[model samples]
Target: MINLINISKSYGENHAVRSFDLTIETAETTVLIGPSGCGKSTILRTIIGLISPDTGKVNIEGEALSTANLVSLRQKMGYVIQEGGLFPNLSAEGNVFLMARYLGWDKDRIEERIDELCELTKFPKDALNRYPIQISGGQRQRLSLMRALMLDPNILLLDEPLGALDPLIRSELQQDLKEIFSTLGKTVVMVTHDMGEAAFFGDKIVLIKDGQIIQEGNISDLIKTPSNPFVTTFINAQRNHLEIIGDI
Candidate 1:
């Protein structure tokens, strides 16, 4: 279980997140969905320790996320950013093994883990030598997943993981990712602007506005009995998408 208790963050004078609170249970896929700049990514970053919140703290599996435990705590979590975030200079295998190598994993051990992750992400072993530029957008995402899962973390944090792909590729990845999540049973928190994606990927949806949670529930609960006008408005804005994706 993960607890984001009373979390808040700011950028100079702008508040990115405000008094936010959320609990991510083990094996559940929780999605942070909202409009652009609504602080969805900020929450993910804060949870992953990419940046500290101005106030409050995070807890993973009953352990507090502090300086003393951050490193060790992070070892139990995997993070993926938009478009794979792969380094240009490294090959797919290199990118996947970078962290393991830094942790002093032996060559054979690293290779074994890489092979396992490749199969898990459904990536071709022969293409491991290819750089980020040499692969398709979808493939880069698979590589990114492989890297994130190489350590076999219990929690997965993703920020717009499929935001860059074309509709066809994006649709394919969405299904694949759903299956992957179901198979892994890892706690997941993902940020996305697409309601369709949220409806499809998330077991529970958390909608935010002005850095605060507007509503948190499953798709049917939000659509059938909205807490406020914004909930209705937000869903109406993406009605076509929700219907097209057969989510409605």
Candidate 2:
């Protein structure tokens, strides 16, 4: 459903992504996992058109992304950035419907979509009027997911969607999010540092370092048949944490 061909992005001397090539299958969840500053998030942003690659191309479905079709192609994607990225001034409902309203959706259509999202994300109808700051971190994330899905985009891009929440809340949301993903079956690409989270949500995991993929496969593939030493080291580094939940 999505492809990045020979993509490269650099900032001064630091290379954020380098010759990265990936194909995200339709209706499947692909997780990008790496340490901080390792460029997984950069790849996600590039796919969403927030960062234009200095080399290569981003293809959505079949069309090549260009300045002319950036906006139109972007409408086919739903992006949820870190910490929800909700507008502080807007109520939860407002944030969710922001894009819809901008696209000139009618009041009835907006309200109907809002209700569906609230139920899908398990968000309370009563809290729709609340602002981002007024809600709990988990609720805020749910609202963020709602906002992303409001347009019913074909692809969902999430960067550390649950990173800001406490562990208990994160666990709860993970379960909820897994169910939501299964229910919707949208093509999903997400970035995270946690191996457990990646294993839980990812149908395919791409482990990256220094802006390049060290290994890309299922969790068992990385664990039982590592591509290199770094792949083993990366897994062992999180072994204890992963064992705590018996997730690895």
Candidate 3:
């Protein structure tokens, strides 16, 4: 389990996140949704120790994320970014096995894990030899996911993982991701702007605005009973007009 207590971060005088608190249990998916610049990405960065919180504590399974434990904690978490963040020079197989290799995994074990991840993500076998630039955007994103899962981390953090794909590809990948998560039973935290995507994949949804959580609940509950006008408007904007009824 991951526990975040009063996590906050600032960039110069502007505060990106303030007094944020959240708990992510094992084997569940938590989706964070908000408009642009709402500090959604900041929260992910803080959790991963990529950005230091001005004042707060982050604990993973009761272990504090201090300098001594940060490295170990990071190793136990998988992080996927929007751009895929793949090395241009490396092949898909190379990228997927990078972390395992760093951890001194044997050649046979690394090969087996790479093959398993590619199959899980439905990546083509031939794509393993290709570099990131040679693959399509969707394929790159899938490869990025495969890399993150290579180590079989207990926790997965995805930041707009499907944002770069076209609409059709985006929807397809989203379904694939949902199924993968279900089968793997890994704890997941995803940040997305699309409410429908959040609703479909998240066991719990957290809505944020101006670096603060406005509301949090199951997607069905939020849609049925919005706490305020903003929550109603946000949900309506994502829903088809045919699905929305009454004053929203």
Candidate 4:
């Protein structure tokens, strides 16, 4: 489980994340959703140790995230960000095996694991030698997933993982990702602005506005009993999107 207790982050005069609190249970997928500047990604970064909150505690499983434990803590988590975040110069296999090599895993073991991840993410082994720029958006994203899962971390964090793909590709990857998540059963926390995606992926949807979570529940709760007018508006916006995309 991951816990963010009273977390807050500030940039100059702007408060990016304000006194936010969220708990992500083990083996469950939790999604953070809100508008563009609403701080969903900020919260995710904090969890991944990419950004340290000015205030509050981050506890992962039984260990609290601190300066001394940050490195090891991060090693136990996998993170995937927007645009695949792959190295444009490196081959897909190189990117996936990067961490394992750094950790001193033998060549044969690395090859074995890379093979497993390629199959798991449905990435073609033939394309493993291709650079990020050489692959399609969907394939690049698949490589990113393979890289993240390469370490076999206990938790996974994603920030708008499918936001860059075409509609058809996005829809296909979303279904595949959910199946992978279920098969692995690792705790996951993802950020996205799409409500339909949230409903499809999240066991619990945490709706945020201006850095604070305004409501947390499933789709039924949000549609039936919104906590405020803002929540209603947000849901309506996504419902409109769903009308365009058809339900996920």
Candidate 5:
């Protein structure tokens, strides 16, 4: 499990996140949803130790995330960023095997792991040899996911993983991602502004506004029991009512 307590971050005088607190349970998928600049991405980065919070603490599986343990802690969490973030110079297989090689896994084990991940992610066999630039955006994103999972991390952090894809591809990959997460049973935290995506993929939805959590709960609970006018307005703006009421 990942836990954040009173987490906050700032740049010069501008605060990016303020007194944020969240708990992501093991083997569950949590989605963070809000308008732009609500600090959703910042929360993911802070949890991964990429961005240091000015205040509060982060704990992963009961271990505090400190400078001394950041490297080891990060090795246990898979992170996928927007646009796939694959290295253009590396082949898909190379990208997936990079971390395992760095961790001193033998050649035979790395090859086995690569083949397993390719099968698990359902990428074409030929895709293993192709560079990121040579693959479609959706394929690249899958490759990115494969690379993150190569190390077999216990947690996954995805920051707008499908934000760059076309709607059709986004929808397709969303299903693929959901299936993979369900099969793997790894804890996942995803950040997105797309409310439909949030409702579809998240077991728990956290709504943020101006760097604060306005509300959080199951999708049904939030839709049926909005806490205030702002929550209602935000939900309406996202077309959540369509999801709640179903199309006529």
Candidate 6:
């Protein structure tokens, strides 16, 4: 559903993305995994138009990204960043309906969407009136997810959505998120440094290194027939943890 072609970006002399090319399939989850500063998030931001590549282009459903179409294209996408990115001042319901209200959605329609999202994200109705600080970390992330899905966009872009949570909470949310993605069948692109998380959520996993794609495939593909030495090294580095989670 989204494609990045020959993309390159640099900050000062450091290349953030180098000659990158990737296509995210429709109704499937694509996980971008790498070490910190490897540019996976940069690629995600590029797809969402937050970062313009110095070279190459991004295409969403065959439409090339440009300023003229950026706003319209963005409305079709739901973005959830790390730590939930919720407004501390806004109540849970307020945060979820922020965009809907801005777009002039009628009260009934907004409430209906919020109800659906709350149920989908397993957020409590009683907590809707609470602020972000009043909720637990997991609940805050759920609220972030609700806010993203309030518009019912066709694509979901998440950058380390579960990175900050404790392991147990993160595991629980991973299962919940996987079910949500399967139920919705939206195009999903997520970024993480954890191989276990990638294997759990990704239908296609792209392993990146030094601003370049080192390998792209299923977890088994990377384990069995690594594209390069770095691919093997990356996998082995996380193999023990992956084994505890079992094969995907």
Residue 156, model 3, lDDT:
97
Worst 10 residues of 3 by lDDT: 239-248
lDDT pick, better of 5 and 6: 6
TM-score of candidate 1 to 2 decimals: 0.94
Model 5 C-alpha RMSD vs. true structure (Å) is 1.8
RMSD of each: 2.2, 1.9, 2.0, 2.2, 1.8, 2.2
The residue pairs that clash in candidate 5, if any, are none
For the record, the alpha-carbon RMSD of candidate 1 to the native fold, in angstroms, is: 2.2
lDDT of 2 by residue, 99-202 (tens): 99999999999999998998899999999999899999899999999998999999999999998899899999999999999999999999999999999999
* lDDT score of residue 7 within candidate 1: 95
Q: What digit string (tens of lDDT, one per residue) describes model 4 on residues 1-248?
A: 89899999999999999988888899999999999999999999999788989999899997889889999999899999889899877788989998899999999999999888887889999999988888999999899999999889999999999999999999999999999999999999999999989999999999999999999998898889999999889888767654767855
In model 4, state the lDDT of residue 8.
Answer: 95
Cα lDDT of model 5 overall?
0.91
CA lDDT of 38 in candidate 4?
A: 94
Task: Pick out the ten consecutive residues of candidate 4 with the lowest summed lDDT.
Answer: 239-248
lDDT of 5 by residue, 31-126 (tens): 999989989999999999999899999999999999999999999999999898898888888888888989999999998888888888888878
Candidate 4: the clashing residue pairs are: none
- For model 5 the local lDDT of residue 188 reads 96
Per-model TM-score on C-alpha atoms: 0.94, 0.96, 0.95, 0.96, 0.95, 0.96
lDDT of 1 by residue, 70-154 (tens): 8988888999888788999999899999889989999999988887777778899999999999999999999999888988899
lDDT of 6 at 70: 98
